[model samples]
Target: MPETGRREPGAPANVPAARPADDPRPSAPPELDYNGRRHRRAMDDATLWDMARRIPTALAQTARLAWSVDRRMTATILVCQVLSGLGTAVMLTAVSRALPHLTASDARTGLTQAWPALTVAVAAMATGSGMWILADWATRRLNPKIASAADLTLVDLHMKAELSAYDTEGFTDRSQAAEIGAMRAVDLADDAKTLTGGFVQLVSAATVLTSLHPLLLGVLVLSVLPRGLGGVIAARIDYRVHDRTISARNVRGMMRWWLTTSELADELRANTMRPYLQSWYRAMCDRVEGRELEGARPYLLVTLLAASLSGLFTLGMWVSLAALAVSGAMSTAIAGTAIVASQTAGRALNSIVRYGAVMFHHGLYLSDYHTFIGEVRSSATARGTTRAPAPRRIRLCGAGFTYPGRDEPALHPVTLTLERGEIVALVGENGAGKSTLIRMITGLTVPTAGSVRWDDTDLATADAESAWRHVGLVPQKNGHWPLRVRENITLGQPREHGDEGVWDAAGRVGMTEALERLPDGLDTLLARSVWGGHELSGGQWQRLACARAMYREPAVLVLDEPTSEMDARGEHLIFRELRAMARDRITVVVTHRLDNVRMADRVIVLDQGRVREQGTFDDLVATEGSLLGELYALAQDR
Candidate 1:
């Protein structure tokens, strides 16, 4: 059965006759299709309502923020704006008084009467300009302080937040968006000032217009409506584009970093990947730009229509004023003043609308910052008043942890004890919950189902910061700080550690020689982008990270795949030093290598988030059908 046989034979090409009512084909609503083509959905009612409500709230919030940042300066700026607005009213009144005299039939007589009014107008202009200068000075001082305060607030929140916050989905996106919010917090202040100035001007102009005639006040309101609506609508379009494209922006930013960063410079050149990277980057940029253009085109068309409407209404206002003058309902002086006042009023109204829109848009982003701060605070580890004691016998009583929004736990309930003066090795394949268990032991996170204790006290009752103080961790991908070698090695420790202490820690990881070879020794900067800065090889950087952990000299040490990037000699040196140091502290090493476990007092094997086996390395090797034996065999085969 050919597909066309189901349709009418006489039907025109690319067109279909009406289908039978019983046909199974699903059809889209014809109303949604414009000119037989589907169109994008308009802004929903909820979103439009949010915009309408947000403007006033955002403006008030921004004013409060600015006042908090600089109370004296904020008051001064507002006072000056009020005086300037009053001066504007006085100047308009003087112009009105002088106009009729200047246009009188007798020229000399007109000049005699108009001169004094003109003088007052000039004086008023001078006062307004002077007040504006003062206001500008205060604004300059206020904005930077607002930005600095907002920046520090965000950083402080991030510093206090727990590690679990970083692991959650959309956390990075929210954090990045929050950074933009911090910056916009400063702009919000500027918008606040502009709105204040515009409002005062509008009021002053309205007062003058009402004295001329009550109907002119109505004319002023009508003149601003079209442009005011257009401004708000445009701002909404921009915000919508920004909200929808956050993920795309993140991808584009990451691609740009990958293409230009010095970290990938070698790989890019070695593999000749520039062309492929460039093409990928171009594709991402095109997608982002396409979305922006799609929004922009429709907004431009709508705004153009709004602008035409505004222009027509403005023309109508002028024509009405001219009619009033010719019919003798108004004098030449009043008509002239009305013309000038109406333009000023329209400008003031437009400024209010535009500034309000900007503040509202920025507030939308600032809300992300506020939400992120609240979330981080809520997720922070519960701080205990009691300081943690030095670790002696750490025990996990059926401890387990499941990540947020997950059904299965990352680590299952398993009772275990780790004592001082012993070295332990955690061996497992990837995703076997090795790192999760390590974090639990260190008090980075509390177990979801059970308790972890240090001697007699539960870890949840111990101060997390104090507990962390007694622990040192060497992560798999350790940070390479763009700081002096001495600063990098002794990062968390007091700066009072002399050169000798640094040398001892570096020597244990075979980093002393590497540091000594540098032009400035321990003082040489580690960043490649700066002048006189040096870059280290991956293995060398790994060694430095190990030295940093050793310098901390904590009661509990956790090294997670610490030697994964190290060369054979470096790995051997670290293991030997760790074995020697294990006699004094509780040491736990997580690794896949069979060679490293041999040095441990005990080896723990994990399978599917459960402790599959536990024993001395030699005992594990002797057991048949053992998971450790299988993993050892696999490593050897590789």
Candidate 2:
């Protein structure tokens, strides 16, 4: 069945119809067709059409969010910003009107006219200065709003996206860049607002120019006509190209960021990977810039020539007005006014073109944000499906699976059922699908050829959130978050975790002693560069991971080699706590350490993707040549 109406390539020509949320099974009756052909309903024209229709609404929503987020401080700042724009507009008109008057006033019009023109210049400067002050104020007010809006988007991405999205290259890579790039939030909004204001100026300027002399206004409109069209055309093309390149740019950007900063730090130190990362980043920039240049170059070139032509036409219009003055058809003052009006009209058009270009091109990023939001709405999965009649039992029925981009199956036709409220240990050597099985059990991946069921309900249609909320996952290599140690331990929950809960969870995982030793107790920052911060060893962080999971007290606890980094004593303490908590919950432990393999009600030994043996720990060791016994002997290095 198609998910989210996306038409995936290499999918079956006939795809199964999507079942209703209530109906777990396909609705087709027997004898409907021999071919068993199904129509795949994925991303269709209707979806895109709907997007087009709602784009205005989306933009309005974003604008509102942007305003509200920063409005607290923005209100204070915007006054100055608006004043700056208004001041600039006034200064421009005043300067244009006075410049010609002063040039002509020297001999013919004399000192009488020169005095008024000089006064006009002073007034223009004063207004411009005032507007500049307002611009500063606006910047201060608007930046916070931009930051706030970006923060809101980030929060949604963190909470609304599935845990798997953080791992996937598409969602993670794009989302991270968007979040970081969003630091320009206020600037982006200001640019948008400036463009809007520019449009208003263009309208007012045109109206004023028309009043000055109708002939000059007509000439201005006709002369700059091509430039206006060219700008709109160029901007639209630039934006189109920009929209198409988002995923590509995002991938390359993330790869470069990772290589230069976080993931490949060790590798870069060892080799010349800095050069490589920089090279990749350079190539990505070229690709992004190349697309825009290629699309808009012609239009821009044409616009440049059109602007020059508009300037020539303005000169021609001024000459005609000068000729009229000489012929006594108009006064010298009227002729001077025509020249200013012509210049103002031309300048307004120039501003329009530039503003149009930026808005059209940069709006593509907004569309990326838009598309992401749309995808979120239809993210309903069978694994996240809920039911009224279903019981709460986790079952993996004939489950088989494979990771993305892998040829071979991770778990091949492997089936197992972990009954409710039973602690089971999944013992396996490296590459034995232990992690893969746990991921499937936890609804991270759908089974390739089987179904995971909660009670009698198919897990595909089961409420995955409810299933996961009751589930706790502790992985071996979970890293320490660069927050306070307490914050790291409390990420397992949704909200403001308490000091008591933090200590309680730490006590379960034997991290309370470490917390007590810190200067600020649980509040001490854990990252090295952060103020009053302290760092911990790998073993301690692993224990913290366990503590984080225990904080949740989930019904299904999955510990994937959770104690691999911890010492033998540390492992023993954690197991002891688990044994105490195993009374009414399902605790599934995935571990290679035979020492931590103690006391599960049953230990299922997996080998070659099959459960070779599952019984009490004693029974597994009793099997003379069993995998568990061999692993135990290897641990002792016997």
Candidate 3:
């Protein structure tokens, strides 16, 4: 009694309804769901020991990256950091040796005796300052190089990945995370340097404290441990908040792009969508801000407790030092020196706590970068070594394709042959597998079942790059490159014959007259956003896309809804050119315009991913009750 696959009354048919876990139909990938799961796992698994372990690993990785970019600069920075630490120790030692002389009862004698020690102290101070300057100079030059290298590596990985990888589950989420990691790579050098500097300072100051008194070193650790623990706790909380709010932040970014982008400005105002989008953006912002505030509460509380404990310990340490002086167990000069060492040690401890936490946080993102690169490299497309010659015939033997995570195939197994110098046209309704079949024929997608071959070379075994040299395709949605018309037509590969070939192709597509009207002719930039650039109308852009494909002079030419936006005259001119060009190339056209099929040598009608009819155009029109005839009659009446 009820219609199959129907929803209940009052349900909107176009809007997607929730499906059961076992549903056979395909659904859009849940991008945020994947992001949340992976990010949560990474954050939740991090423990105190794990954080400690990750710090050195992160520093080593940063060092390796810096070394690869510029080894001389990296070595200079390392030597500067090490020498700076030694300079601090020498300066403190000189000051300690000068204390007794400077404090002697005879003022003139104290000045004379302390002169050499004071001179040594001044020179050590200058050396430390000079090393800081050198390190800073080298870092400024190296950080940009590191960031550029990271960005290039990410782009290279993206170029190598198979086209199908983009549609795979979790791939997009991993890519976004990897991009964040790549951007943070610029911070890696600073984080590592700060961490290294802190550790050096701690070691130098601790050695000075030990020389003064072994018990003083113990007091120093007691005073600083609470603060270090607090920093680690706060970092953990911050990472959790960041992981949880990533999805919401990504949504806000998308909303912001839609609101500000020039391409959508007109439609946004025309449809009065600004307020709706603004409200959506504000909601996501509030969600992220709420999570941050929640995280901040615990962080503030931990820092407060840590600071209170540290203050008490510092007071006790000062009291102990004064008692040692008063009890005559140490001299007044030694006590004063100990005071200076304590202050230096305190500052060094603070640096260690602060920079260590930062390095740990950055390490989490760096992990994402390494994971994504490995995954992409392992899954990169493998083009066979067998070189393929130019195709004379293309054949598909029972080729079918089913998308990832779907039970039903997008296209049924198809058996067909296309010969050079023959023009074939495909007719179909929406979602009738026409585009899928075209992609299979063009080698853009590999079939899940069966094989596609060019001459005797199977696409699965032949070299993809070599086989692609003879194919040219124009899809329904063509790219609008912001380049000069000449470069756009040639796709940056200029022919040896130059503008003569460009003009010939433009004339065939009826674009030569329009191009000639421009101030720079073929040199005109097709981006209105750029200075001195020109823009073309929808029909003119379509004509340009057609001309680009024709310029290739490919052995196989495939056009999908190529003239959808063109006027009657422009459309007629393109079909006439196609008829002439079909004499040498294997041309396949996908169009819903029934009138255009009259120019095709053979017409194949598709319905629900299966071939329903195939014959010459005149023969199909003459047949009684044929699907093509019925579709043509309906179009004529409209």
- The CA lDDT of each predicted structure is 0.82, 0.65, 0.82
Give the top-scoring candidate (TM-score): 1
Q: Any runs in candidate 1 off by more than 4 Å, and if so which?
A: 1-50, 106-112, 230-253, 266-308, 530-532
TM-score each candidate: 0.86, 0.65, 0.85
- Candidate 3, residue 68: the lDDT equals 97
lDDT of 1: 0.82
Q: How does residue 404 of candidate 1 score in lDDT?
A: 78
- For model 1, residues 1-638, the per-residue Cα lDDT tens digits are 11112346875553445656885443211111122211112232235466558777776766677788899988888899999999889988999999999999998999899999999988987897788789888888888888898899889888877777887877887887788889887666667778878888899989988987888888887777888788767766776676556556766787788788777999999998876566556655665787898898879977997899888888998898889889998888888888888788878877887787676566667777777888988977766767888789899999998887688999999899999988999999999999899999998888888999988878888778888888989988899899999999999898566989999999999988789999899999998776659989988998898899899988999999898888999999999999889877899999888888999999999988999999999999889988999888888898
Tens digits of per-residue lDDT for model 3 on 191-248? 6776787788778877887887788788788777777777767666777888778777
Regions more than 4 Å wrong, model 3: 1-37, 40-45, 233-249, 272-305, 331-338, 530-532, 606-612, 621-638
Q: Candidate 1, which ten residues in sequence have the lowest lDDT sum? A: 29-38
TM-score of 3: 0.85
